[model samples]
Target: MEVPVMFTLQQFVDAPPSEVVRAFTEPEPFAAWFVAEGFRTPADRVRIDVRPGGQIAAVFVGDAEVPFTLHFGALDLPHHVELRFDDPAEEITVNLTELPDGRTQLDYRSVGLTDEQQAPIKPGVATMLTHLAAYFS
Candidate 1:
């Protein structure tokens, strides 16, 4: 059996889970930090429906404009969320834990990727999270 290329990343944001979750569910905050350097997720092009079976759509504009839609698998507000990429086989799960110090611990995991797939995605995710942390700062 072929193993899926997967990765998990954790970060502590200096904000509560409610604020962290807002960054994920809100288009403006999402667009602000969801992209790597040289790429942009335009807030105007983002459409979000935050609920089970709902979807978020956005266009990542760089040298090319790539449109993608993520289908919501599960949404536990301010706590957990699962989103499936355009291909249902690929999914990302995000969990937020409330820290005692008024911060939030975020756990992010991506599964069902091939080696070729990880090349861009892994780095992109890292950059996205970095930008997210900076957004909260």
Candidate 2:
């Protein structure tokens, strides 16, 4: 059996948990910050149905247009969300914790893949998290 590879990228957003969650769950804010450097997710292609088994689908426009969809797994308002990507067969969890200073600590985790599977994804996720943090700055 192959070992499951897990990686977590954390960022401190200068906003409340609700806003941080909105940046991941809402279409407009999601499209703005949920992309890697030099890539854009078209707002028109983003469909955010925030329910279990629902989906957030969008096309990443870059050198090539890649269409991807993240299926919703579980949702705890302003706190936790679980999303699964079909092609890569990865489960992503977003956890938001409100700090004492009122900012939100966002933990984005990806699991259920091999190290090789996650190698290319880690950098893009890191870049996306940086953009998300800057969105609130």
Candidate 3:
């Protein structure tokens, strides 16, 4: 069997699971955290059927307007969502956990992709997590 590629990132947000989930799921709210400040980017499109085989697309509104699409391969409500990105060979798994003290921990892993040409993600993710923490604080 071919093994999938993996990408890992963990972030602890001040918000509860319910609020964090909303921030991640709802387009406008999700943009506040997922996209960078002064980005002038719009969540061009974020559609989720919230079911297996659902489709999603996010187009960053910038000078380049880069876009990404994914097909939801699996989903477990308020817990995890698995999707295959534009690259069929890759899979992204996102997990969420409720921590004590009304905090939420989000763990993201991607299998089947190479970051050889891209900036390493760990530090970048940490930066984004910091943005999220501040945004939700």
How do the residues 45-65 of candidate 1 rate in per-residue lDDT, one tens digit apiece?
999999999988999999999
Residue 25 in model 3: shift from native, Å? 2.1
- Two-way TM-score contest, 2 vs 3, winner: 2
Give residue 105's error in model 3 in angstroms: 1.3
Scored by CA lDDT, what does every candidate get?
Answer: 0.88, 0.87, 0.66
Error in Å for residue 31 of model 3 = 1.6
Root-mean-square deviation of every model: 1.7, 1.4, 3.4
Clashes of each: 0, 0, 2
Q: In candidate 2, which residue pairs clash? A: none
The worst-scoring run of ten residues by lDDT in candidate 2 lies at 30-39
How would you encode candidate 3's per-residue C-alpha lDDT over 52-119 as one tens digit per residue?
88766677666566666667777775777777766545676778798988888988776765565124
TM-score of 1: 0.92
C-alpha TM-scores of all predictions: 0.92, 0.93, 0.76
* lDDT of the structure predicted as candidate 3: 0.66
Q: Which parts of model 3 have CA positions greater than 4 angstroms off?
A: 1-4, 36-40, 115-123
Ranking by TM-score: 2, 1, 3
Stretches of candidate 1 above 4 Å error? none
In model 3, which residue pairs have backbone atoms overlapping below 3 Å? 5-111, 5-112
